[model samples]
Target chain A: MLKENKKELESDVIQLVPQLTLDCVIFGFHDSSLKVLLLKWKGTEFYSLAGGTVRQSESLDKAAERVLMERTGLDKIFLRQFHTFGNVERYDREKIKKMLAHLIDPDLWYERAISVGYYALVDYMKVFPNPDALSDACEWWDLNEVPALLFDHEEILEKALHALRLELSFQPIGLNLLPEKFTMPDMMRMYEAILNKKIDPRNFQKKILKSGIVIKLNEVKRGVAHKSPFLYKFDPEKYEEVLREGGLFFI
Target chain B: MLKENKKELESDVIQLVPQLTLDCVIFGFHDSSLKVLLLKWKGTEFYSLAGGTVRQSESLDKAAERVLMERTGLDKIFLRQFHTFGNVERYDREKIKKMLAHLIDPDLWYERAISVGYYALVDYMKVFPNPDALSDACEWWDLNEVPALLFDHEEILEKALHALRLELSFQPIGLNLLPEKFTMPDMMRMYEAILNKKIDPRNFQKKILKSGIVIKLNEVKRGVAHKSPFLYKFDPEKYEEVLREGGLFFI
Candidate 1:
């Protein structure tokens, strides 16, 4: 394992895109709460989004997918590149420098560091988070309760959340966060959770139904405090068509 | 002048962001056609988007502004980061290597090169396009008729156009492209050019009016074949409010 880990960090890695890193902010919705997958470094109190150096021969998109799969053991997910953070100071602060000293020379790292932030919206319950060799534990942190993250990761996470919220306002990305089949109320709860606000139930229902991207499933909520809501599933074909036609317009 | 240029390339230039570059896709609406800023390499048939290497200390946004000002002699333009091109092959082709050999060691350049793509919507007549030290000319090529561009610039241009068109469909970014006081027909023409499709004048007028983002300027077109259309300007306060609320909702 020690040899394997050292080989992974070797300089002769084919087509390695040096001084470049990829960070994934995997957002998931579970138990009516919005959460993000985070990894804590081994034997340290510091935490960060799963990050990987880009391989030289791979496109940023492919690199992002590789990193996501390596960290969470999940693939074929839609990973959106929200922003590339290029502030040279991102790894220059003394505390962050100390946190990263073992992994990279802070002086050289700060000289050429730029990170592309990619985000994935996944069903939290389905994902099996796996930490990389450097970290021992990976878990989901509630969007509202993330701890102090290492380096410039907290800012990256904030921007990822902002990008996700902006897209959710219009794009039907909840398909990535929700289960295959869920009650309409569950769908509504997820949206409310992401938006961090309560929406008018009647208006929300009417708008979604009018959008025609969701199909009524032949099921209902089995156990609930209130009357069970009708089950719904996203119509992939209609969803793509609607998304192409500027997505679901949320007013 | 040669000595001055040599000194500019020296390593002593403070705060240079090594291995990182900024490329701008300056989109301008002109003669009812959407266009982009392109720079032709000096003594070569090759053309590329105006690009600049990043200085180490300044933020990416500031570097983008600096590059835009150096290329177009325009300042205070709102340039949006659309994508980051980190493909190792972005400058790996033989022809591109030769074209850029004098500027960078192609081997080293290919190893760590990553470019941040930015797009700006500016009035066509407002910019005075200027070539950099390596280019002989800078001009706007019609988005439909752009010649073969150098490096992966063509891909960058396409993505920028796609981003611009997508945002134009919903966002009131026309605030940047249109003159302060313009007629309804002028605004409609700009939209038609961007969408590459004719819009029904009546429906377009109705929608813009309903958005409540533009304020009538109490003026009319001076001379036109049709009856002079009412002139208007984006209502600053209302425009900001609408933009903050996620811009015009064009269905």
Candidate 2:
């Protein structure tokens, strides 16, 4: 089965667009810090974002969506293309050839490479990552503790974060990284995680009330020390409209 | 000389990255409308943005800047890559083959293509358009009067304009499309052109004054049918800083 799979992979690789790859920077809010989805390559010290080469018939955006779904079981989330990484020496071609010597032709592997970077904000609890043959593990890594990435992925991630931050200051996008029926405090945490700065709770509540992106649910939480904050869910129609024409940011 | 230039172009075409092109959407503000730079292909009824194939060694961004300079005779403009067009049939293969059959191998000319779109705002008076071999002329067209483009350029231009509008609402970037010295009325006109709506002059003046991106020049303009408006220049140091850090838009 493995041999047959490898043969199919080789055929697909031959059909793939040469020297181009699609790397996804998937950001999710979990615990306190904003986290990114990363894959640990099998039998290697390097890790990378959920990424793959473009197929012959599909667009780069489609390839990115396919890769994100294959790695993290995510679908229907909008992945925004932030930038393309095309530095001549972004990746060590010789080192990549050495690493994939058993799997691919070194000459083919060493072609001057370029990759487009796409990013999406997904709810941390919803995504269940499943690594493929190239990697042994897929997990969320805290942005602060992100270990050394394989190539210029670290730079790509940095740019993605910067784009996200700029949007956060103007658009209501942090909700995508929060679960439905979340408390105001969790939403605040998500904003803080993306902004990397503390947002006053009162200020956030006031701004959110004016933004009209959130709908207050009738039910309140029971598990709390003093009082339970009312749960809220995003108004899908309003959110989609705002997503197209951005809303005022809480900041 | 024409044949020799054609031969050199063929060589450069051979050195280009397979199936990938770079198209630039150069925007300028003149009179009262937002304008875009476009090229007229020699034989076709269609026109398109100033665009070219990417050389094998240079990055896509570098290729875009080169195309911009070669076409407009302007340099030092920083273009931002807004999107990539990668539909399988983005450009008609049969049409391309018929167009380039005499110059290139039809097999090579008809490869499935993708394009990266870059946009820049430049002063209209500073740009001197130059047409290359494949094109008969290059000119700035009002955004409303843009003719039917050769391929997906129409779509690409639309996306670029959308990005510029989004940026215009938050970033003080429209100054690049203006003359170095201009009246407050012209500045307001630039915003109206970009935002595609009339702005309250009083409000715009209030915002620009508070933003401190513009300097009150010692000289004032003597114009007919109106009181003399002060000539203003961008505070180079502060404008550069706002450009780097993005100033508040005069929306």
lDDT of 2 by residue, B1-251 (tens): 13345567566655766667788999988889999988877766558888887777888878888998898888888588888777677767787567645544554443466778899888888999988767778989999999888777888998998888777766776566878888888888888898898899998899887878899998888864778889887887777786677647554
lDDT of 1 by residue, A1-251 (tens): 12344555555645456567888999899989999998988778889899987766678889999988887778888789999987767764777667766664555443456789999988788798998877878999998899988878989998897787777767776777888888777888998888888988889888888888899988887788888888899999888886666566663
Q: What is the TM-score of each candidate's chain B when compared with the real chain B?
A: 0.90, 0.88
Docking outcome class, model 1: medium
True contacts kept of each: 0.72, 0.35
TM-score of chain A of 1: 0.91
Clashing pairs in 1: A15-A56, A16-A56, A17-A56, B15-B55, B15-B56, B16-B55, B16-B56, B17-B54, B17-B55, B17-B56
Look at candidate 2 and tell me the lDDT of residue A177. 76
Q: In model 2, what lDDT does residue B61 have?
A: 78
- Each prediction's total of clashing residue pairs, residues at least 3 apart in sequence or on different chains, is 10, 0
List the candidate 1 regions with Cα displacement exceeding 4 Å.
Answer: A1-16, A98-109, A225-228, A243-245, B1-18, B98-109, B200-203, B206-212
Identify the candidate with maximal TM-score: 2
